[model samples]
Target: MRIKTTRQQHILRIKTTLRWLLYYLLIFLSFIIMTSGTLYKPILLVPLAIAISINNNIYGSAVTGAFCGFLIDICCGKLFGYNAVILAFFCILTNLVFELYLKNRFINYLMITAVVSYIQCWLDYKFYYQIWDYENVGRIFVRVSLRVWAYTVISAFFMYLLVKLVNKLLMPKEHLTIEEAINTNIQNENKR
Candidate 1:
């Protein structure tokens, strides 16, 4: 069983810290792009939020989602906590789904991001604009949901690729095979 040397451990720690820093930088850029509002609409925040959630632990994901959502809300001038609440809930939902059913696959992440983006669009229309006219309800829902879903799916692919790339670059490759792990465990036991 090969153990990592002290110098290697220190390098690993630095890499981990840099990886997390890159994550925050990506998230901040997403917030800025989404809030710029130069496009017809923006879906970067939702998919990026979901990507972060998928890559982190449940509580960590929740906190990240809430913080990003809060920034979004402040940028959009919505109710103080509205975006934060919805984003945190969506993050928790996706994290639970990942834990229970979905593998950490790109397709699953894309689908979840699309679904969450659609739901967020619906909520935005309802709360921000109060669009309650029954006659145009179906039309509005179909139009907004599809547009948001499309943009979100596109953005999800980019964010997914970014995560994969950064993880590959910054994280250490786990060289310990199952047999190695078992041997190390036995050796530790003998030492104790």
Candidate 2:
């Protein structure tokens, strides 16, 4: 009886995990589709962050971060991993500070997008396009950096709206907050 019960619990857990994963994958797909078109000029990063942050997976955030980063690099036709590295780091940091009153407000995320956009744009300008030219470095920095930053911030708002909408279509089950889950386990063990 004990062994059967344990096996059943394991199966149930696996099913729950798989279901959660499938939902996130669909949300990620929809996000890509919405951003790919002419409606938005590649402000996908901010929206990606908003989307990832809504879910319960810490690992998912990083995975989606790299995915979106790679997507941006590919769509914009730039060297690979330029946005991936930065985005992965941002997601990791966001995961770490989830408990620290970090509001999910748009402007807060927009600031993050703007800052990362600045760094990404600068790196692309300095390293990829103007590495040897050296003459137009100043102009490139001013124009490209500002353009990307503005675009990213603007895009962040749209992404927030989309995330809000997507949540209704596919909300994941509440898999307890980290602290709550641990506490519940402890309580159950004490009872046992």
User: How well is each residue in 54-167 modelled by candidate 2, as lDDT tens digits?
Assistant: 444678778877877777666677679877777777776765565365666656666666676667667777787687887667876666666656776676676667665555
Alpha-carbon RMSD, candidate 1: 4.2
Looking at candidate 1, the ten consecutive residues that score lowest on lDDT are: 127-136
Model 1 residue runs over 4 Å out of place are 1-4, 37-39, 131-145, 172-192
Candidate 1 local lDDT, 8-104, one digit each (tens): 7788889978988988899888877877765356667778878878766799789978987888788777788888999999998898899889998
TM-score of each: 0.78, 0.65
Model 1 residue 150 distance off true place after TM-score fit, in angstroms: 2.2
Which candidate ranks first by TM-score, i.e. highest?
Answer: 1
